[model samples]
Target: MENAQTQLEINQCAGINLLAAKRKLVNVLEKIRHAYKSASPEFLTKLDVSQKAWEESLEADMEMKYPLEDKRLQYGSVYPMCASGFESRLVLARVEFLKEWLKGHQDGDICSGSIIHSYSIQRDCSNIGK
Candidate 1:
């Protein structure tokens, strides 16, 4: 019973963190949209392409690291429960990068065509591997 409760708690935590991370990313993207509205066509195109590339890269990385599979009844795979946590970590890293860029803006507005450096936060998933 205790182990079951613990598993339930882990699932819930993962769900909540995933939601929060997504929300943060959305907020950051909205900010960028507002900031880049008046940018040159070429610059805007580049920004759009880069944004898509970043998301695709993140998704590909996640899929590589955590291929969606249910082995819970067999070898006791916890991936089913841990997927949310891994996704949350990735989203949170992007969110943090955006937030830092916003903070560093000199005029309180992200300048059009400005390229902000991307930073990634390293996360240890060793605990989840168990």
Candidate 2:
């Protein structure tokens, strides 16, 4: 019994992108205001455009937040620009980030009961095969 319980205790929540979850939730809420702003068939075609743009803008802002020279020819924003399109982006970004985190911590998910049950099922299948 003890041995059987060993494998099932493998996976656990190591950490998560709270920021990403927050972004997703905000996205869901934002969509409520405009009645599914990004759900339109026209918007779905763009896919991840909003997420990419947000990350890029953030990276740029990080670069520019420092002291800049005289009026530059470049037009840049100091931070992420939230567009009506961003609702979906935020949700996706959050999910991706958390997925990344999960990928890393996936091995931590295990339990003894699950292991035992799996072994039991395998044994049954093997016997059936025989």
Candidate 3:
């Protein structure tokens, strides 16, 4: 983007960045699915449903951001670049959110829920009150 002097060039760069972010998102999601492969069928179904809902939410957010019927006409020439950059940020955020599943929580954390527990730290939670 440093050399993107023209609006067209900037817009193209933004679009390319957006595509890269989307690919990263796909990779993260695949890793998450693989990590939880041993989970029950119902867990997998819920994961799929959650992903679909997140996608719908993302689309709704984009629509709300640019509520006009004709975004290009309403926002002018830079609309494409802005929209692409905004979408890229949102996707990167989602990737970060999904990464927690891969990282997992400490073994003693009882609230870890479905996330795989990490036994790297051997902590005793039973003596917390003492």
Candidate 4:
């Protein structure tokens, strides 16, 4: 059926998008690692350690979103396909967050104490929780 084919395509594309987003996130992290190379030794060590933990957390979160125990028949079920879409969105969010955080760093807007603080606070904070 046409609807089934479309759903399959969407599911496949979602997986590709998720992989691409994850790659982008890793690339951004690598850029950040390089950008902060001149920081103090303590900071560099902390960054390295945190980077490993962050990668682990990402893996864990992805596994949670697509657990193997809940496998659905791909032919008639939409659950697995929808899971891919959700994963794609989550990965894309991480990519955007890293990019925005990098932009904040480049803008020298860290006078607000934290890197993301200035950008988030300066934005229309009213729309944040909405």
Every model's TM-score: 0.63, 0.25, 0.87, 0.57
lDDT against the true structure, each candidate: 0.61, 0.37, 0.81, 0.60
Query: Whose TM-score is higher: candidate 2's or candidate 4's?
Result: 4
The digit string of per-residue lDDT tens for model 3 on 1-130 reads: 9999999999999999999999998987776676666756676788789889999999999999999999999999999999999999999999998877767787587887777764321132222225
Query: By descending lDDT, how would the candidates be arranged?
Result: 3, 1, 4, 2
lDDT of 4 by residue, 62-112 (tens): 677666765575324666567766766766776676665355433545462
Clashes of each: 0, 16, 0, 0
What 10-residue stretch in candidate 4 is worst by lDDT? 120-129
On a 0 to 100 scale, what is the lDDT of residue 99 in model 4? 61
- lDDT of prediction 2: 0.37
Q: Distance (Å) between predicted and true CA of 87, model 4?
A: 1.8
Residue 73, candidate 2: alpha-carbon lDDT: 25
Report the poorest 10 consecutive residues by lDDT, candidate 2: 6-15
Candidate 3 lDDT trough over 10 residues, lowest sum: 120-129
Candidate 3, residue 27: how far the Cα is off, in Å: 0.3
Which TM-score value belongs to model 2? Answer: 0.25
Residue 3 displacement (Å), model 1 = 13
